[model samples]
Target: MQNFDYMTPTRLIFGKESIVKLPEVMRSLGKRVLLTYGGGSIKKIGLYDRVNELLKDFEIFELPGIQPNPKYDPSVLDGVRMCKENQIDVILAVGGGSVLDCSKAIAAGAKYDGDPWDLITYKVKAQAALPIVDVLTLAATGSEYDCGGVISRTETNDKVGYMDPLLFPVCSILDPVYTFTVSKKQTAAGCADAMNHTIEQYFVADSTLLNDGFCESMLKSLMVNATKCIENPEDYTARAEMMLCCTYGCNGILSLGNSYSGWPCHGIEHALSAYYDITHGEGLAIITPRWMRHILNEKTIDRFVKYGINVFGIDATLPKQEIAEKAIDATYAFFESINIPMHLREVGIDESRIDEMAHHIAVNEGLENAYAPLTEEDIKKILIESL
Candidate 1:
């Protein structure tokens, strides 16, 4: 096992009535609340009215329309302005991970005197941040439980995953009931996102059996429950389990004592999503198997063999190479089965900028030092193969 230190201070209030505690939770943090959200899904789901009723005593200011791939320009900038102007006490992030992510950036940016981009890019470390309390409505990204958030600077075509302990939500209300209405496409994409989170950590160079088992079981649960969710979106039991799995996905609990895999898949997919504004999870699903095929070799065959046997239950007696290849195929088939676009073109991404994206990823993502190190040419080949 690799040496490591871990801490998760976010208090999780899970289950049906979790949101009822929102008022009390925010009470300790502040009276002036910055309510952040994406689109108007909360209103459609009645969560908007419910939250307004619950926190009626507090002064609330709104920052709406935080998009997926959470942009830094307007959302983060506007949020910071709102916080500073209103002297916001705490942020109440509604909607999904993108809202929470933008809120995180706003939280940190609210306290920093420099450009918020400075803090996000690590040009300056955040000394303090506005407290955040989230009511999670999506099961993807795990931003509800993790301190890190991916923020994009669209002008630069950069999506940076920023992490500072100060950015962790003080409290997260995870009421699975709220997720029962999530659409079928989002449900599958969410499962793909969480599955990739586990796979990134599981594929590391050094890991314990305990962590591996945690990942394997979570992947199995996500697959089974995702199928259930697609068939019946209102299946409370499936939604609850999948929600919990995603909540744990990026919080480091699943990868404790595991060597860093450099999260190569995420590294590559970040560029794809940043440049194309594609669905983050769908981009990952499209790139993952191709990355797997490109990286498979004698040095990494053992992990693939174990993944194939333990997770997918491939015949143990098969040759290691065959097992690895089958494992990759099984991964591809699973995403296809879930109805995610398996090819880049299917998602409206084409080869026009493949070379540009490859070079950009090579320079910015630092994937040259990944678990299965990839060069610029290697990345280009993978992108081409993905197409």
Candidate 2:
């Protein structure tokens, strides 16, 4: 175990009808509200009307169309301008991770005197931020529970994960009913995203048994519930479990005393999504197994063995190497079963920018310091294998 200091201050109002609490939560935070969302899906599902009805007393302003892989230029900039102009007291992010992520950046940027990109790129640290409250409609990225958000600069083809404790939402309303209408594609991708988050933390150099158990159980739960979700999107029990699992994914709670894995999969996948505008979770699913295969060696075999045996129930009596390989195969198969494109080419990425992406990832994401220390060449090879 490693020395650590941890706290998750995001108050989770979970279960059915949790959105009803949004009014009281927002009232406690402030009066002037910046309501953020993406693509008007909330309106289609009637959540938009319910939220408006509940918060009819508050001074509300709208910042709609916050896209996935949230952008910095218009969304973040416009949000900061709105906050500054309106003297916005709190932000109500009412969509998936993208909206909440954009809201988080806006929350931090509203208080800063400099460009929001500077804060996102870590050119400067944040001192204070506007309070954030979220109603989560997607069970991915875990942004509602974590202080980090991945934002993209489309012109520059740069996606950066920004982290600051002040960026954590003050409260999150997690009603699985909100996710009942999630498309199968998104639900599977969300499960892949959550699984990748856990595996990133699990495949570290040093970890406590407790943390390992947590990771393994979470992985199994996500896999099982994800399949259930794909089969029947209206299965509230599975949806609820998967939602909670993903909420716990990136919140720093599961890996409390574990050594850092440097989250190399995310580090690499960021480039794919940034460059190709690919779906974040689909890109992660495509990269994860290949990265696992590339990093599997004598030093990492034990971790793979445990993951195989515990999570996938691969026969523990099998040869160690066989077990590890089977585990990796099982991972790839799981993603394939969920209908995630298992190749970069399938997602419209090809060799043309493989070198550029590898260099970008090596330079920007610092994968050289990852648990297995992938070099630029290693990244290229993984990308090729993924293709």
Question: What's the CA error at residue 81 for candidate 1, in Å?
Answer: 0.5
| lDDT per residue as tens, model 1, 1-387 | 888888999999999988989888988887999999999899999999999999999999999999999999999999999999999999999989999999999999999888999999999989999999999999998999999999999999999999999988999999998998888889889999999999999998999999999999999999999999999888999999999999999999998999888898899899999999999999999989999999999899999999999999999999999999999999999999999998999988899999999999999888888899999999999999999
State every prediction's TM-score relative to the real structure: 0.99, 0.99
Clashes of 2: 0
Report the number of clashing residue pairs per model. Answer: 0, 0
Off by over 4 Å in 2: none
Give the poorly placed runs of model 1, Cα more than 4 Å off: none
Give one digit per residue, the lDDT tens place, for model 2 in 296-381: 99999999999999999999999999999999999999999999989989989989999999999989988888899999999999
- Clashing pairs in model 2? none
